[model samples]
Target: MMYISELMTGAPTNERCPLERRMYETLDKLKIPYERVDNDPAASMEECAEVDKVLGTEIRKNVFLCNQKKTTFFLLVMPANKSFDTAAFSKKLGVSHMSFAPPEKMLKHLGTTPGSASVAGLLVDEDDYVQVIVDKEVAESEWFGCNPGINTSHLKFKTQDLLQKFLPKIHHRARIVDL
Candidate 1:
């Protein structure tokens, strides 16, 4: 069974990765109160179902994608249950040849590995190179859920805080998409 820790307020007291630490620091600085749970790495949506049940919010499916030329990168946040239609996403963004970005590029751009990609990684995107696209459904949710920067932990906070505070603090904005 996947071990999901009890609900905790704010960030963890134990040591964490720089990216994870920074995520909490940024949230603290912004006064964005959140609830979190530490768990065995839940990399896939299926693995996250338990975490979601514990947190009382569905964790968003975060995907890192890139254009064929590799000049542009995008971090898409959508419902965990929603399937990603590459062709539809490409058409919606008017970008061609969209495909999942490689792990190395994900690290370079989002400061995360393949299964750990989250909007929180935007903190390391100092250059604002990665464009964040959020699904309309996720954008309208009362609470937003995602990992800090790793797959072993998950967080939930007011969606407003994410849109009005967190993204702005990271110097990025989410472009809402129906997909």
Candidate 2:
């Protein structure tokens, strides 16, 4: 059985990786209150399910994508349960040929690896090279749940804090899409 502990706000007591540490510092600096849980590495929905129970919110899918050119990169957060139609996403965004980004590029731009990507990665994008996209539905939800720049730790916080405070501080903006 999955081991999901009680929900608690702020960073965990145990030591964390550099990436996760930076994420907590960033959140604290911004004064964006959050609740977090250290679950199994979020590689599968089964693990995500256990996290959802602890967080009291559904964990959204954080997809790392790039255009056909591979020059334009994006991090898209959508409903975890919904299927992502790349074609539909392309059409809605007026972009073309969206495909999953290479893992190396994801690490380079987002400071996160596959299955571990999160909006907090934006803090490391000093170049502001990657665009952030959010599904309208997820953006509208009262609470936002995502990894705090690392897969093992998951966070749930006010959607407003993410949209209004976090994004602006990082000089990143979120383009809300229907898909």
Candidate 3:
């Protein structure tokens, strides 16, 4: 797929999707600079790799998870290639088990679909119910990339800014883990 700029008549700033718009608004409010790249709505990990190439950064896998009772929710960010060890994660979080959160909960809380879960959606999470977890390997990067609350658009920002400024503004905190 071609760059959004080449395929579209106007700039990405004029794109649709309330989630993406809200994320950009927050970035503007904080005076944080970011570069956004739009791609096909990738449906699988391989397709997401194409988006990663276009964005020139690795896209972290954003997983929406919940404990058995569903009282607690988590948004785990890790390297796309990393395998999620439920037992290890449960042990780390002190939970019995962590299963994938349903689509309804994901939409209600993160304002995103299964393939589009991203930290950027935290902009819409007024309750701040979801815990954000980042793999230490992914966190070590100087820059990090994630969806701009839409599957077709990805945003890249300095890792320090993302963890320090962007996440705090959205009332989200990151827990670095080896998983």
Candidate 4:
């Protein structure tokens, strides 16, 4: 069984991976408050349900995608139950083609591997290359939760802090879509 700890406010006192540390650094620098929980990789939605109970909020699914040529990349954050439709997303975003990007790209661009992509990951995107996409429903939510560049750790914060504060500081604006 996965170990889901009770909700703990703020960043962890213990040491963290450089990537995870960098994520917290960014959040702290932005003066954005957050709550976090450490999990066992959180490999499945069922496992995440336990984590969600501790955070008392929905933890969205994050997908890393790329166009047919791999020239354009996207980091999509949407509700966990929302099934991804490549064609539908492309149509709504007015893109020619889109597909799941390889894990290598996730590492190269976001500095994290599979199962961990979030606004926090975008900090390593020095050139601001990847397109950040958030579903309208998710953007409308009051709270946001995702991994801090490490699947083992998940965090909750104000969605407004993500959209209005943290993201803008990184020069990233989410492409808000209904899908």
How accurate locally, in lDDT, is each candidate?
A: 0.93, 0.87, 0.81, 0.88
Q: Distance from true position, residue 30, model 1, in Å?
A: 0.3
Candidate 1: stretches off by over 4 Å: none
Q: Per-residue error at 164 for model 3, in Å? A: 0.4
Summarize candidate 3's per-residue lDDT along 1-179 as a digit string, tens digits: 53342222212656579888888788778877777776767676677787677667788889899999888999999888988888889899888978999999999999888899999878767898899989999889988888788887777778888899999888888999886
lDDT of 2 at 22: 85
Task: Choose the strongest candidate by lDDT.
Answer: 1
TM per candidate? 0.98, 0.95, 0.91, 0.96
Estimate the overall C-alpha local distance difference test score of candidate 2. 0.87
RMSD of each: 0.6, 1.1, 2.5, 1.0
Give the runs in model 4 whose Cα sits over 4 Å from its true position: none
The better candidate by TM-score, 1 or 3, is: 1
> Lowest summed-lDDT stretch of 10 residues in model 4?
41-50
* Model 4 lDDT at residue 85: 90
Itemize residue pairs with steric clashes in candidate 3: none
Pick the TM-score winner.
1
**What digit string (tens of lDDT, one per residue) describes model 1 on residues 34-114?**
999999989679999999999999999998999999889999999999988999999999999999998989999889898
**Model 4 Cα lDDT, one tens digit per residue, 147-171:** 8988899989999999999889998
Better of 2 and 3 by TM-score: 2
| Candidate 2 vs candidate 4, TM-score winner | 4
